[model samples]
Target: MKLLSRIDIRQLRILSSLLQERNLSRVADQLGVTQQAVSDQLKKLRETLDDRLFIRTSNGVIPTPYAESLQPKVEHILAALEDLLTPQTFDPRTVTRTLTLCSTDLEQIVILPKLLKILRREAPGVRLAVKKLELDQLSTSLLTGEVDLVISNPDFAPPSYPSLSLYPEHYACVASKANKTVRKQMTVEQIAQIPQVVVSPSRGDFSGAANSWFEQQGHPRNVVLSVPTFSAAKACIAESDICGFIPARLLPDARLRVIELDADVPGFEVIAVWHNRSSQDPLHQWLREQLLAVATTP
Candidate 1:
């Protein structure tokens, strides 16, 4: 307790800002402190913590493993302190805040367009930044305030975080309009024989959600090509004889024909995930509400 008391809250804020800003000059500018003064504070923090919190890098500074591990706890501590000191109110219309979100390309394509339209009207001053979703690091990122929200499959979300079902994910097979193998209706045998363009989001991985479903149903897929994103899969189907599986939420391109399969394709829920700490935050809650509204509409 005595050692902790020696630490200044202002220094803690500086450390937190460093994680976001990465560069000393930027942090100093944001905090209205000299670069040398920020360096001095970092020096004091390093001595107090007995760890080199950040190491100088070509781009800026990178947090040490110890510093990286401490980020979520520090963010929680600072947020709790701020909540205690300030009135709990967020005026979306006038507040200028940047919200960072992580999501797959599919969700970004399906969700962001409508959400951005609503935000333009409802929260004109708010800004949004979207980062590609890194599933393994999402939980820690959310807890540390590195990302404000995550839109992804429920299975990918950490169990510790609170999640709300955004929509039920449905998939359909797509093929070029010129492909003769695909018709109005397809049976298991016919679908199995046709070459498939499987979307393996990780790129190198050979299997995906649709592949797993095919396995469970005792059907074999001839995966002619493996791609990383829905757009790529659709493009492959549009140009080639091979068919691709795509989430139903994505509108069908006029060039590609949607193939109706008789066999069942397993569906999972797309979820909006966030750390429990932000569950009651006005901005967070409002964002979730808007996402739910967009997801449920049509």
Candidate 2:
């Protein structure tokens, strides 16, 4: 088999579209060309491949066996070519662009406030939209351009995208003053037995570092309820015996008492992720720097 050239691949894509639509006119409409243009391209495609790539059937055009076999390779090559041709760089200060970021509520509550403040003060023209995405979807979203950046737990494996650790935060058990059992610190067993409000922000299976530590010591926690937001869990904890695992840095003025976990649960890092294609773009670079500075500052 001969190696397909770039022109062959482009023609293959046009042929693929015709196969999908069946009607030459419809394919031409989609491609912003006339029916004659579509027919010409189809002729070129058939001659180049030396095969009837698509055959007109009663319903529509049907791809031949050869075309069927080449479809996957052709699609992959065209996608790669599209990526190669797409412009990746962005300029923050000058570009009036909206960047979509996927992150948990924890990042919204802790990091986004400061980050947005910096954007307002520095990059007034830039707009930010934040969405809460499940952990499983982060990598796919980055690859598909559904999200421009992802701020998530360090435990999440960095995808093909470039990522940087924004900051580190320790886990602390927080409860209301009215909760009599946990005043300062609670033992592993005590923590296990308590009515715990688990915060699974990303619909992640593991509860948190504190829960992981307890389970590692052969003591699994009795999570009474699982909430999506740390604030909601905190609110639930403030009114009842429910205790929540929260980031240590989130302990300033909330009406909850934060106690260090008895187990040596190491702090987790927060990461800022973006596609390598956009990593060096001036706007993305500036936004990343602002996020890091905000996350690290006291």
Residue 35 miss distance in model 1 (angstroms): 3.1
lDDT of every predicted structure (CA atoms): 0.84, 0.75
Best candidate, TM-score: 1
Segments of candidate 1 deviating more than 4 angstroms: 19-26, 51-65, 140-144, 202-204
Q: Tell me the tens digit of each residue's lDDT in model 2 across 1-298.
A: 4534525654766765765566777888887878887778788777776888888877768878887787556645655666677467655556778999988788898888998888887778888889985778876666545688998876775656678888888777778878888868667787788888777776744465566677788889887788777778778889998787778777754588876666666678889887655654567777888888988888
Which regions of candidate 2 are displaced past 4 Å? 1-91, 204-207
Q: lDDT, candidate 1, residue 132?
A: 83
Q: List the residue pairs that clash in candidate 2.
A: none
lDDT of 1 by residue, 1-298 (tens): 9888878888988999898788999999999999999999999999999999999999999999999888777888888787677556677797678999898888889889999999999999889999987867887788777898999887778888899899898887778998876798888667878888776555346666777677666887788788877888888788888987788888668878887788777777999998867877778899999999999888
lDDT agreement of model 1 with the native: 0.84
